[model samples]
Target: MRVLVTGATGHVGRHVVAQLAEAGHDVLAMTRNPATAAFPASVEVVRGDLLAPASVPVEGVERMYLFPEPRTATEVVARAKSAGVTRIVTLSSGAVTGGFDTDFQLPVEQAVEASGLEYTHVRPGDFASNTERLWARMIRADRVVRYAQPDAPSLAIHDGDIAAVAVAALTEDGHTGRWYDLTGPELLTRREQVAAIGDALGEPVRFEEVSPVRAREILERQGGWGAENAGFLLGFDDYSATGPSFDDVDWSATLVPSPTVEEVLGRPARTYAQWALDNVAAFR
Candidate 1:
């Protein structure tokens, strides 16, 4: 099948493209900036924007790996349907337990399903790569990180694991209509995760505690977050600090780990430690 992968330059999308090519599928990877996209020679690189998906030529494309961008989802789906695309596998968040993202993901899912395409939703929780966002700067600067949630545990699947399930659903059968809750093999707390990175780096990385209030303040100051956005972000930070609590009736769906990756890919999921080890250069 001829497959077009959107967001091909992204962390998850790159893996999807590579795995699809390995499976002997004709792969086309779409990036807003094709000149910067460097995939294996087996894959075709193309210029396409998810916001303007219709602008990309869909001729001979049969399948797609869609990242959720709900705003233009209708137009993207409409164009896919018109082009006779048969299947769509989306990269969705496991945060659907409740939040702005849930509201964002559901409609995008609906758009693809309603587009007369076979749909598989790959929902991954707290990507292990997210640590890069949270800790990279601090790690690079002083090998010290401060955050509100030191003991808060997360399922935190690898970006590769998320992409593996997506490739399984896209290329193989029996995955249609399946919702894969992608997670790592074990749960680790924020402090433990930093320690794992430290191990990978052959150095010590210290975790310092910051109050949610103070953390938001620091983020607002250092990260230049608007006051409102900082608080909104802290709401999630506070939630994560409590670990896996379904206490909030409204946000009950906070992601919990499942054996979906092993079940789908026939192997144990990747460990956060391994992810840290693999990308250790980023920390240094």
Candidate 2:
């Protein structure tokens, strides 16, 4: 299959491209800046931006791995359909649980569904790598502070696992019209997550809980927390107080059986400890 992957340079997209290449699929790695795309030489890199659908050269594409939030998802899907693209595997978010009416993901999902292409929606939970954004500060200060609900638990799947699933869905058959919820094997609270990171680093990592109001203020000062994100975080916190039910959702019957990290990477998935050990230098 000739597969075109958008956001090919992103955290998960990069891994997806690698896995696709390893599986012997012809991969077209799409990026806005081809020069900056770090992918294997076997990948045919292309200059394309999802924001500008007209700029994409969609010839000879049999399948695609799409990332959500492109400016023109509908247009891009339409073009891919016209170009004889048979399958589309999208990297969608768990936020769609709130429904398309309230979530930004709905539009992308609608576009893909309407595209008339055989599609598999990969809806993954919180990414374990999202911790990297805060690990540096935690390592330096020896403390991790956030507006995390102490009682709420999340099964944060590793990005590599998510990518592996995407590759399977794109390359294998019998996944069409399916929505897979990819999550980690176990659920852990925010406090427990911090402890896990500390265990990985061979040190104590303290987690300080902040009130939602304080968290919002801090995020606002940082200039990156918008109202929607703030609401989502706070809502998630509230939901956690009752225990996270989403973590219990069944996924045993996926077309591609969930592969353990060790199985997918031929080594253990990078645990919080392993990640901390490997990236401790970034903390300095």
Candidate 3:
């Protein structure tokens, strides 16, 4: 089977490419910068960006691991179908399932569903890798994580685990038409997550509580994903409400770990502690 994986250099996409290659699939990794993209020697690297669907070459591709870019999703799915791609596994978000997301990933999902292609939606909750963006620099600088909601909990799924599910959907049967809501094996508080990172580094990492407003301000100043989503994550803004007002969600219901990863792959999903240990170098 020839599989084309877009966003093939991302945290999840890279794993999807590597896993597919390891599974003996003829993998085509689509990236915006093929020169910097790294994959197994057996994998083919091609230049493409979902923002410009025309750059993606789907010729002879039987399946795809699509990274959502709503701007061109309809066109991208059309091209894939025209080229005879039979199946597609999307890297969607849990927010879609929670009914809090409409503009971003939902549109992409709609496009794929309308394409008449076999589709599987991988809706993963908070990524374990997000810690690198939110706290890695702070840990490296002072071994401390200062943020709001220290007791707030999350089931932060591993990027590789997400890729594993996507790979199974792409290469195997019985996964089509499934919408998988995935999570890590355990739920941990913000403070506990910081502690896990410290444990991984063989040191004590302090968690200092701050006001959510203060934290949002700090994240905004830092820029990147932290800045972009500071309001949404910190609960200052709600997508459904479209403005300021706290308590739009019940964290207790949303933070529990899901068994879907283990159910789909026949193995335990990675824990937050294991994820920290696996990427300890980032904190160091």
TM-score of each: 0.89, 0.78, 0.95
The candidate scoring highest on TM-score is 3
Better of 1 and 2 by lDDT: 1
Which tens-of-lDDT digit does each residue in 72-182 have in candidate 2? 888999998998999999998765642322334567888999878899888776777666553445456645656556666766777877898788788877679987766
How far in Å is the alpha carbon of 45 misplaced in model 1? 1.4
Question: Model 3, range 1-284, lDDT digits (tens) per residue?
Answer: 99999999988999999999998999999999999887889999999888888899899999999999989999999999999999999999988888877778889999999999999999999999888899988899999888999988789998999999999999889998999999998878899999999999999999999999999988888899899989888877776454323465556678678899999999999988998998999999
Q: Which candidate do you rate higher for lDDT, 2 or 3?
A: 3
Q: What is residue 57's positional error in candidate 2, in angstroms?
A: 3.4
Every model: Cα RMSD to truth: 3.8, 5.5, 1.8
Tens-digit lDDT track for model 1 on 1-284?
Answer: 99989889888999999889888999999899988887789899988887776676577889888988888988887888788889999888665424435456777887888887899998887788777765787789999987787988877888898999999898999989877767788879899999999999999999999998987776666563234356654564333332344444453234456888989989999999999998899999
* Model 3 CA lDDT for position 155: 90
* Candidate 3 global Cα RMSD: 1.8
Query: In order, how many clashes per candidate?
Result: 1, 1, 0
Q: Cα lDDT of model 3 overall?
A: 0.91
Deviation in Å, model 1, residue 84 alpha carbon:
1.6
